[model samples]
Target: MSEGKKMTSSRRLQLKSLMLQIATKRLEEEKKEVAAAKEAYIIENCPPPDLSGDMAALTEFCKKLHIAIDKIDEGRYDIEAKVQKINKEVRDKQQANCFKL
Candidate 1:
């Protein structure tokens, strides 16, 4: 009947509106979470510099920062090399198994 169709359409619109509101809330929460994560990353990895120091003190601080960066880079390189070695070994073993089969 015409009345039934109208009721169904009204319910559909209400559901759509509710879903849109929920989605908007979820999007806002995700944005806040992302912003928090970025702030934490900056706080952990990008410390604020001591700008009130003399030139010599500033130079020393820079040198220390550079050394820390170099150490992190070396550690990353070592891990990458280990991963490559393991991958190569796995491939070699797989090929050997295929040949045996």
Candidate 2:
């Protein structure tokens, strides 16, 4: 009986170790996937600046880029606000329906 118990314990330990290894591997894979996605996003949305230009040209380029970024940020904020308002309305309706039920 004692030998059987030892075997069971050993098997459980082995299974637990295997599960941990698998979970660690999955976490590593997810990290890699996230990193690849981040790299792709940066490549697509954040173009590298042209460093071959004169100081004046570079300054002008930076000024234009900053203005464009500000505009994009404003648009994003507006859209986010709208989405939040819509979500709140939906939630309120859901709660009202739940109370009626």
Candidate 3:
């Protein structure tokens, strides 16, 4: 490639890398928000009974919370995987272009 074309390609690659980093950071923040929301949901909707001795009910509440949290985590994991895959693709493309230059 010509010098101008190579410089442009390098700049484009840098932009892609920056964009991917921003997206990854945003996803991480979103995951944290989801976790906080799950915790809040559990607290708000499944308050412990006042019996002070009902271990069974407390355990059941905990179990339900665990299931909900797990589901949220699974969804976040899927999103993260997709972001990572896209990041990898961008990196691969950038590397290939670099080699061509």
Candidate 4:
């Protein structure tokens, strides 16, 4: 392999690695933001039912809270899957480039 070609390949790998690192950091920040938002939403909207001797009302509130929690979990899973997909694509691209050299 020529010297120039080797340098170019090395630079490309460095750039790819930097990009992957930045993307990973961004994904982590996004996940943290989502978690914060979910926590805030739960705090603001899912207050405990008043224990004023109303069994039916308390049960209904509990049911609603369960549903909300389930939805939040599903949304978080979906977001995580998307982040993983992006990470996988970056990894695949890096592998392909490595094989090219």
Per-residue lDDT tens digits for candidate 1, residues 1-101, read 36453557889999999999999999999999999999999999988887799999999999998999999999999999999999999999999999999
Model 1 misses residue 10 by how many Å? 17
lDDT of each: 0.95, 0.95, 0.91, 0.92
Off by over 4 Å in 1: 1-32, 44-46
Kindly list the per-residue Cα lDDT of model 2 for residues 1-101, writing each as its tens digit.
35443567889999999999999999999999999999999999999888799999989998998999999999999999999999999999999999999
Q: What TM-score does prediction 3 earn?
A: 0.45
Query: Candidate 4 lDDT, tens digit per residue, 7-73?
Result: 6788999999999999999999999999999999999987865778588888887898899899999
Task: Rank by TM-score, highest first.
Answer: 2, 1, 4, 3
The number of residue pairs in model 3 that clash at the backbone is: 0
* TM-score of every model versus the real structure: 0.63, 0.72, 0.45, 0.51
Q: What stretches of model 3 exceed 4 Å from their correct place?
A: 1-53
In TM-score terms, candidate 2 sits at: 0.72
Best by TM-score: 2
* Residue-pair clashes per candidate: 0, 0, 0, 0
Candidate 1 vs candidate 2, TM-score winner: 2
What's the TM for model 4? 0.51
Off by over 4 Å in 2: 1-9
Model 3, span 1-101: residue lDDT tens: 65553557889999999999999999999999999999999999988756564889878878877998999999999999999999999999999999999
